[model samples]
Target: MKKAIFLMVLALVFLTPQLSVHADGPDQMIIINKVNNQLYYFDDGTLIRQFPVATGKEDTPTPEGAFTLANKIKNRPWYKENIPGGAANNPLGKRWLGLKVGHNRGHMYGIHGNIRESSIGKYVTNGCIRMHNNDVYWLFNQVAVGTPVIVTRFQGNVEEFAARSGYHVMTWDGEMVDEFQIGRVETLRPMKLYSYNEKGEPIAMQWVPANTRYQVYATDGKGTYTVGSNKYLLYTTPNDTKYELVPSYIKR
Candidate 1:
């Protein structure tokens, strides 16, 4: 009875704060609506801001997955043939928030503004999430580097990707996705209905993989997942030559 009382007290001590936060809570979260083509910002359960956006087309669509604000560029030029000369019709407007999506296709995908406000809510661009010129400028002011930026079309659950070391980069239709990063992973590891850390530590054994059109997840807690040519690295060198050496997991 004494041991049972001690365990009960310990559970209450840890769980009390969690329950309190969930109840009278104000979530500090941001939301992106793919159907409405709008980005909504929230602080403490209240809607703070919203912005019009543009998404992908039918084919070669903008991938829907959780991402992060990798880097922010000021006064960047639009890459493609959106505009000819200077900043007149530049699709990227004045700011660029580079999003590191599951597909590590670089800044080829991000949240920026276009000169054409009429195309703000339509299916335009190769596979980028576009916003209005002024709206993006405001958003640039709101978020900082490394802020979470989930880009999805389904239910909005933001599952974070593991570290670069834990991710085994593989090309799917020429875009990158994370698999279990263990060396000698022969088969595609069965999606274990649980959550893992960047170092493959099991967090919640009851966790399930969140569904996004282009989402990623770790399969198991073993050192046998596949990467580029094998199950060790994320990307490979030219002609299946070598793998990139990523750093080991950094525990906080």
Candidate 2:
């Protein structure tokens, strides 16, 4: 009995460090939506924060795919093409989150702050994701090294991609909608339609008829709009089915 007890204690000691490390493991996931020019931050499967970002230009498009946050540097020096870091005109803002993108780990691309605050919502970067100085500083402190970062140019809105990718969908009002619902707002032009479940799971993909119209009652930040008193997220008629939002019908 004594020998068994001693072995158990040794095992407990060995497991303690492992448990502690896992207890403090990374709890954040970042998705950079290139199409919408937005950055979404998720903690433990829930979206906790979002920020507008500037992506790469057409000629120098931002690299898309999965990457790991490999390094975090504050006030990093910039010496690209003889442009010194800390210069008034330096593009690197106040913080940098370097990425380990695939086999190219030479610090070629990353997410950083920019001095040009006006460019926050535009696609004007050479390739890196640019954020406001305050925003980057906040993000730098929230995420730790080795966190997972996915940079992708989504085909639709962030909500659609998030639902399709199995991430929890958050409404603009901060409500969590687990089941996927169709958007009901009709667009003047035809658009692709996708259906999803409460857990943000995709159920179907199709195309809507062109020139459809609907009276909008409500909208969810994820591109879902309600129509009529029934509040149907999707409206189907004999000749047409609609889910895309009409920009003019939006309440603002």
Strongest candidate by lDDT: 2
Query: Clashing residue pairs in candidate 2, if any?
Result: 78-85, 178-198, 178-199, 179-197, 179-198, 179-199, 180-196, 180-197, 180-198
Can you write out model 1's per-residue Cα lDDT over 156-183, one digit (the tens) per residue? 2111111111221132222233443322
Q: Each candidate: what lDDT?
A: 0.48, 0.62
RMSD of each: 19.9, 15.3
Q: Candidate 2 lDDT, tens digit per residue, 127-194?
A: 99999988998998899886667677555444434434433334432333323323334455565545
lDDT of 1 at 140: 79
Best by TM-score: 2
Q: Which stretches of candidate 1 lie over 4 Å from their true place?
A: 1-28, 44-46, 81-86, 103-106, 154-252
Q: Candidate 2: global Cα-lDDT?
A: 0.62
Question: What's model 1's overall lDDT?
Answer: 0.48
lDDT of 1 at 25: 18
Instruction: Give the poorly placed runs of model 2, Cα more than 4 Å off.
Output: 1-25, 82-84, 155-160, 163-173, 176-252
- What's the residue-level lDDT of 20 in candidate 2? 10
